[model samples]
Target: MSVNVPKPITALEALERAQWIAFAPFVFQAARVLRDRGILLAIERSREGLTLEEVAATAELPIYGTRVVLEAGLGIGLVTEVDGRYRITKTGVYVQHDPMTRANFDFTRDVNYHGIAALDAAVASGKPEGLKVFGEWPTVYAGLSQLPESVRKSWFQFDHYYSDGAFGAALPLVFAGKPKRLLDIGGNTGKWAAACMKHDPDVEVTLMDLPGQLRNAEQNLREAGLLARARFHEADLLDERSAIPTGFDAIWMSQFLDCFSEAEIVSILRRCVAAAGPNCKIYILEAFWDRQRFEAASFCLQMTSLYFTAIANGTSQMYRSTTFLACVHAAGLEVEREHDDLGVSHTLLVCRPRPM
Candidate 1:
């Protein structure tokens, strides 16, 4: 039987979606407040559902605040009202409890909420205007170590939530050749370096990143007792002349290239190729927008691309798989192996320098 493909949304559905977008800020905070203030939890625990009075009492909130927020939740579809009672919908349940959703929500709230206001200007000027909210940095990465504690917590949580799961599945693929030396580019906080040391006792790992970033990463590796196996090479890749040290058996870039524009990525790849010896394998792991299995995941990535525009770096975007592949070819590299759906939403591209 032929599968029934979904058609375009009807006019009414389109209008509804438009309205949701128009009031997204209000709706987002309503859901956040509902979840954070315990109102949603109170409603979920009630088998028969909750009246505004009961919700207020249970959550220790004033009835006036409870009623208005729950009323907004009805419009947001996070809660439904029947016979003057409120209960959490399936989406509401996920919003309140799903780990990934919770992380993304907190990230949106704590990191992007105020900064996003400068999006239009950031786009117009091709600069991270939102970054001014935190400090005078060209990109968020430069200011990461200096960001407020809460912002740092949420940012790292969101970053690791997506990448950490892929490490367990990626380790074996990276070590398949039994390489004694490995280089991990953009090895933030040295988590991947530590994991590499733990995975193979004989392997020595070199972590390359900015000097400020290496400070935290080096400390972590030292505390984990992986310092002997892990070394640090600090250099800013944005500098055209920045050199990547040569002679490693394998190189790894996990969610790293997405932090750069297409041009920058190509330049960085060329540097990697220049440093790669014969028989060296280069691994590029990223959540390519076009490679996602679900449209929702793709949508999430596209939305995140805007975050890069307004907050992280204005030039970078979450690239399509095809776009990234072209950069690899431009750098005189070929994909020797491709791994997708490893964990969460990542795709791993194992590459080798093209024969001269």
Candidate 2:
């Protein structure tokens, strides 16, 4: 006699699997605590490795508590265990030593980890707590300078990822034409200029930023063997005295202009128009909100909008492409090209000055 067997019920199985869902918050909170203490870094630096007791001592965690966290980290692939010793994994190395890794962790610890759950308050009130979190700081960029050297290095390191051909693969495309006389407005550290010069040796790139930021840009460009091709101009975006230099073939504004009102953006665009020759091309890259893209909603954008509003009194939501087109029209420019890449919140708007 053959026995009939019943098929496994998928819904019931899924419910059983969901039993651990409630523990997710505790797990995340615990991981954050371990990350802030440099526990992962300590493990990475310890050649010949350290025992659990030693790691606990170095991290100032109680031995039992340290063991529990390390065990969890090991299970999560952040650490490896052989016999009684623990070693850092490849992911661990990236987190501990990689500039981007360090920056991301520090950003999370300083900005996100403390009050991630308070996002509802921001949403409800339409206000950010970043200023409350980081007191007296006019902008996140300004506040970054006040971070500890280790944390600051991490921030800069992570910032490199944006233009380092990781985020949108846009830089490589932008540098392909070998255009001479490039203007990088609000260019932080001149990373894009350095990248441009790296690809095309003949291109001359000028980085314009605030005096303090310009000093850093100068140093960074010089270090990248691009000082000859790159020049630094110190100016504030808001001040008329800080006018952009004229007759550049191409202009770049990356992650800029979002920190201001629509009027301010129009003013800046007008200045860009004045500096641009008839044939000059302008590149404007920024994150924008789209109501149609449901999955595109990101916590980072939510946090940034609130933070910018709270601290800089700047708008954070995506200014629509239509609005940008209007600005281009007001500035006597036309949008020649536009691109929206997958997995990135930014929109690239390429424009050219109108014939007078």
Candidate 3:
């Protein structure tokens, strides 16, 4: 099968990369601690590299702790040291100040770090063994509403970072048919619903998801003064018997299907097919790995799939476009239009339920 992979590297260079891999987890925590403790910021504030003594003084940490983290930061390419003084590297500044990078870092540490410890077990069992770290649930969605405030913050921010930007671009495509009503499947926190209401004053949306999630969505819609234009439905789409309310002109699933396994995705789509009228338009927005323009972006998505295995749901991953298309066909949906590069990493597939 054809795949897009990075160019080959020399044996010595590969070995150096392997060394970083061996120390990555430890190095990640060191960077987190350093950032949290103000060591990195203190170093960055110094035009000239700061002496170990100065960093310790500014960070209010013991000299030994500061030295260890700074040394590891050097190894991680987050900082540089010369003649007993340290300064932030270009990479270090991004980690220190960039919003996206900071969000990714916090998400990886606060939400996925401990759970990732059970990755091997999750892989072996085909279950979210690491999810036990938070609480017992088949998937993270069941417990998303109850996650600690910090974890929930990072989780939502990480999710919205990639998806929120796509809303403006997606609006015209979704409203191209001027549908009076839309069904937003898996509409967490009602962000998309609010966007829809604002984009088309006459359009009304029904936000559907698990009951726990709808509470969050209701709160958001209420805050946005969109409660009148929005309706809520609580159902687990994974259950074959759970009915999807019908009669909407459009159905929108944004960054939603990636939460389930291949079979579950097919099942959900089939349900959509059952609920959707012949004329209903279905829009699925996903960040498929193979569709990414940059190898780095693809690489980030490939790693995030592991987060699904260990923490989110053991069955899903960042999918390839072909894989999602296959599921669409299996569910008797035809891709009527395809939009790519909608945001930093999303591709929108506009579909129609195939005739029986």
Candidate 4:
């Protein structure tokens, strides 16, 4: 069944799924341990299925622990067993090797796991209550720089993996008008800015973000020797008084706007309109859950909203296109064109300021 519709299930089937949900935490941890302990790999490497003892020996784990985890993996469909032997299943292979899965897993484990308990409070208060796991901050963005090293790595890796894939396909569209000056709002790490400059030598790129984020971007650009080619503008996007710099030929916000609520999105876009010139094209790249071509992709996007609630920012979510379009309209901007299925699962909306 597609994510667009809920599957109809028999009573027994519903019970089965309920059971899975009940023990999902244990199954998930078992899968992680199996993947990390090489137990899954051991089974995969065996030309013939491996017996419990053989699997334990090959993976170099205690027999009792290996047996318990392997059985748990079987329930989760990560491994199969017959005739007292076991082998890795397709699901196990994905758990072990899928880059997206790796990114999502690390992000969940390192960034969201500890904080997830506060999701209820976050929902009730309309604030990132789980953010307390890291430090006292209004939102994750404010304290991102001071986050522990592993937490920071997972956050950036997860953030980049989703958005970075879309940039190559987006480059041609952004440069179609040969924009001389491009403003990248929420330009985390300046990856987009660097890409724009590489695509067009004469195009001047500016990255606008908070001071801490700009510091990270500046260091990255400097190490790549692209710092001289970029401009940095420090501003807190949530502060309405922080004026958006003006007169850019192109303005880009990639996977950026979803970090705010509907009202905030409109407020930011209105600012963009005020700063935009008559000829400026505003490009917004986002992963709208409703527009996803695959059920799996849509499911992932929907689940990510939980991260926003408990870890990232409480009030935002992965929106449907209709909801998002309303924000664009409310901001006094109109979408001129749309391009879907950009790399991975992204939709690019080409917009312009609505005429007064």
Candidate 5:
């Protein structure tokens, strides 16, 4: 690929595309109103198409309001109009039904909608200035459990939807050596640790994270009857004085390191390197923008990096694989093997201690 790429669209087309971005906020809200008001569903169910009156009646909305939203949806490609009736479009089908679309939509709307306006402030201050909308916490992680019930649900749905698919595929590789003791760093919700124990009846797992997150993970593990095999360590990785627990056969970090900056990642990995025995395996599961199979996935990741900047943590963003690799090497670890294109957008790197 060339560093300087030629333009693919004409100037007229570029200007037309620019208009879509200019009205994006209005268009997004229009789509949401149509979906939530049942206007889209009413149109979708009609065998032929829904007349303006029919849509208004079915959705129990005023014809004046319904007409404007339908017209907006038509221009947005969420709905199509023929003569005088409206029908759902292919794009609308995905907007209303796709799992990934739903997760991203709810997350963006519920959690990021208002906060994202502070992007410029966060960029200038090097802090999550948008997090002020929720509370005066160091990061979103610290205030996660205390967020509104609906907001918390959206966060978890967005977080788990991306990682749940990768866990099944990565589980076998992590246990290929049949590690007896595994340390799950940043074990959010205990999902991966539970999966490991279920996959291997004899493997004992330890969860290390902040005190609050540990409580949530403990409750989840207990509910699954896996607590007998699970242990919890309240840890604060940012504290340089804190020492990570040692003597584990395998150390796992899945979508965890990406939550930190490169400097923080190096510091955390150094702790992992210090803790690992000679034969220990350190696995990292992440979605690197450069490693994505599709341009759309890459675009989504690029935009999501802004969420980290504006809301999650000001210093961290989803990293390219090359940048992430330097951190691992800096911590005295080397990638023994790399498996890309795992279950959903993830690259699994199996790292081992560097030789003297």
Candidate 6:
């Protein structure tokens, strides 16, 4: 007689099992340190390959520690060893120059590295002890201003991961027929605007951000050869009398809302609605925490929240779609389409002005 066999497990079940199996704190911390330092990128750049001696000389790590680190990286498949020389693996290329790399590094070095260490204190006081941990400014952005220029430049790379895939993925979908005018609020470095212009040559985009961020955005747009297609507007979203141009065919808010309190989000949403005309389409891209999907829980969210609280004086959390829907409703707009990409921490909400 044949024994009864159990049915095959689902993909979701397999993913859950893998997640738990790989959730060691030591492994997580080691990964963070390696990713932050551009170690993988350095290996990739060394076309001639590098040895422990070379790595130690470049990174200023002790010879013994360098060997240990390289070995650990090799075990993790981030590096490949050939004839005693180390090189970056194909899968590791993204971290070397990818936008996600910068974002991840920023979260670890600037935010989580310090914040998580004080989790017990935060829990006891019911208030984040971010400044105490960072020992500098109250906000991450402000604190970054104090770091060496080299360290500060890494954030530009991180901005790519947040905007490139998540925001860029939705543009074609939202602007299927090519809209005439596009407004990008909190548009840092004008990368989203550059992507929009790249996709639709006829589209003229405007980027609105803080004055300092506007300068960076202008430089980026100019470098991307998109200066002709975009204009920079300097204004804080929190300001009541801030001038926001109206009658645009499309309005884009990429990775902007989650930086503030609920009240601030409501105010910004109201302002966004007022800036759009009856026919204007709105696209909102963000990372939201999915309450229903435990597999969807974000390490980026947990880490960034801690970082923002400690360093940027901002708040980062996985917001809910219902919260956004409410904002749309309050603004007299209706959701046209909603797409949530689970693999990456991104959600896209398309909206149109509600009929009077």
Query: Where is model 4 more than 4 Å wrong at Cα?
Result: 1-3
Query: How displaced is residue 230 in candidate 4, in Å?
Result: 0.2
Q: Kindly report which residue stretches of model 1 are placed more than 4 angstroms away from their true locations once superposed.
A: 1-6
**Which segments of model 2 are wrong by more than 4 Å?**
1-28, 36-60, 63-103, 111-129, 132-137, 142-146, 166-168, 175-178, 289-299, 311-314, 317-331, 342-346, 354-356
Per-residue lDDT of model 1, residues 1-356, tens digit only: 11123669999999998998999899999998999998888889899999889998888989899889999998888999999999899999999899889888989998999999999998999898998999999899999999999999999999998999899999999999999999999999888888889999999999999998899999998899889988889999999899899989999999999999898999999999999999899999999877887777787888888889999999888888888889999988999999988788999999999998
Which lDDT tens digits does candidate 2 get at residues 50-81? 78998999998899999888887875567887
lDDT tens digits, residues 1-356, model 6? 11123458999999976875675455445555555555666677798788878877877778887787678777666688998888888656755556555467554554456456665665455445655654555444445445556545655555556557665568777688478888998887777788888888899998888777788789888898889988778887666778678878888888777766566676777777778777788888877655224442454565566544544444444466677567668767778877877235677888876777
Note the Cα lDDT for every prediction shown: 0.91, 0.67, 0.90, 0.91, 0.90, 0.68
lDDT of 3 by residue, 124-227 (tens): 99999999999999899999988999999999999998899898899999998999999999999899999999999999999999998899899988988989
Q: lDDT of model 3 at residue 233?
A: 92
Q: Can you write out model 5's per-residue Cα lDDT over 1-356, one digit (the tens) per residue?
A: 12123459999999989999999889889988988888877788887999999999998889999889899998999999898989899999888888998888888888998999999999999899999999999999989889999999999998898888899999999999899999999999999999999999999999999998999999999999999999999998988777889989999999899889899999999999899999899999998888887777787788788889999999898888889999999999999999988876899999998998
Work out candidate 6's RMSD over C-alphas: 7.1
Off by over 4 Å in 3: 1-3
Candidate 4 similarity to native, TM-score? 0.97
The superposed Cα distance between candidate 2 and the true structure at residue 53, in angstroms, equals 9.7
TM-score of model 3 (CA atoms): 0.97
C-alpha lDDT of candidate 1 relative to the true structure: 0.91
Q: What RMSD, rounded to one decimal, does every model reach?
A: 2.2, 8.2, 1.5, 1.5, 1.6, 7.1
Clashing pairs in 4: none
Candidate with the larger lDDT of 2 and 5:
5
